[model samples]
Target: MTTTLECRGVTAGYLKERPCVRDVDLTLAAGEITCLLGPNGAGKTTLLETLAGLLPHTGGAIEVEGAPVRSGRPRDAVRAGMVLVPDDRALFRQLSTKQNLLLAVPERSRRSSALKQVLQYFPALEKRLSVDAGRLSGGEQQMLAIGRAILQRPSVLLIDELSMGLAPVIVTEILEVLRRLATAEGTSVLLVEQHVHLALGSADRAAVLVHGRIADRDSAAALRADPGRVERAYLGTDAA
Candidate 1:
């Protein structure tokens, strides 16, 4: 498989001395979805932010298709074909849905076709094009957030807490969209999720992070067969 995104020995956090994530190594292949699972405050978001260049890493390097991504330089990440959909769906609250999606496509000539493509993945959004993003339901807002990212044509997509505050049915629907994106667009996805079962179900692989370190990693099928092992890792009773 071709490597789309990779990080080696990354360490990052709010404070210099106490890194929230330390010595982390991760890789994503084209058209693959890897679920990053960990307990709350285990630095899942920190790791994703570091990888996306939203936060500077104190150590190690991130690369997209062999091009280095400079720390704390979001443009570098974006230029390298990496995009992050934060836990908070950062949509322009007052902007119409169409406007929000249009902002991601800088070329006016492509906006119409790009939006039409997005609507194919999320047909529901077509009806809400005139509606303000803030007025959409949680699920619709998430769809908009991801729709905006898709418009950017990201090769590597990092999503933080995609299932947060959403219903199970909605999460399932979104996961299906992600699968389609991976299959059709060949986008590499790194998903940070708290819902272990759902994440494992949709991902090709799973990595368990415990207290800022990777406790275990394996094929999602293997993890699903041995849920006790994953449970132990989350409980801090297992490492590696």
Candidate 2:
């Protein structure tokens, strides 16, 4: 099967001399949801950022649909059909929700299509279109951020910490949308999440990152079936 995204021995960090993530090899298949789980400082964000072309990779390569993606070139990544939705939401706080989402489609002719698609997934946004993004609830802001990303029609979506600072109900709602996108739209997703069980529950596969490397990779069902193993991987005891 062709992979939507592939990272081969990718190494990157904030400092050029000191790499945070090293020799990470990961892949996301089409229409699959891959959950990345790890504790704080595990370099999960570094890996995602590197994959998204926001950070330079000092070694190895990243490929989207069998083509090389230039490291540190975010626009090139977007052109390659990859999009990253960071934990910050990256919404224009002062702008109304409609204006914020409309920005996703630069061409005025495509703005309606973009808005329609986003609203299809997040109907709640239609009523709140006139409201400022900052004034919306946390979940609503997240929905808008994700809706904006989806408007880009990316082949691979890298979502960083979708569950951060949101209620479980809201998280569930977002996860459900992701599941549908993966299944119905054939959009591959790489999700970094703190809620291990919730992520593992919705994901097709899960990878545990420890000390900037993948400690274990397995089917989500298998991981859920043997959570003690996942715990060991999370605690960095698997290698001991």
- lDDT tens digits by residue: candidate 1, 1-240: 999988899899989899999898988899999999999999999998888888999998888999888999988899999999999988999999999999999998998899999999999999999999999999999999999999999999989999889999999999999999999989999999998999999999889998898888998889988889899999989544
Regions of model 2 farther than 4 Å from truth: none
Measure candidate 1: CA RMSD: 0.9
lDDT of 2 by residue, 1-240 (tens): 558999899989999888999899999999999999999999999998988889999999999999999989999999999999998989999999999998888899989888988888999899999999999999999999999999888999999999989999999999999998888888999999999899999999999998999999999999988879888998888632
The TM-scores, one per candidate, come to 0.98, 0.97
How many backbone clashes can be found in candidate 1? 0
> What's the number of clashes in each of the models?
0, 0
Q: What is the lDDT for 47 in model 2?
A: 90
lDDT of each: 0.93, 0.92
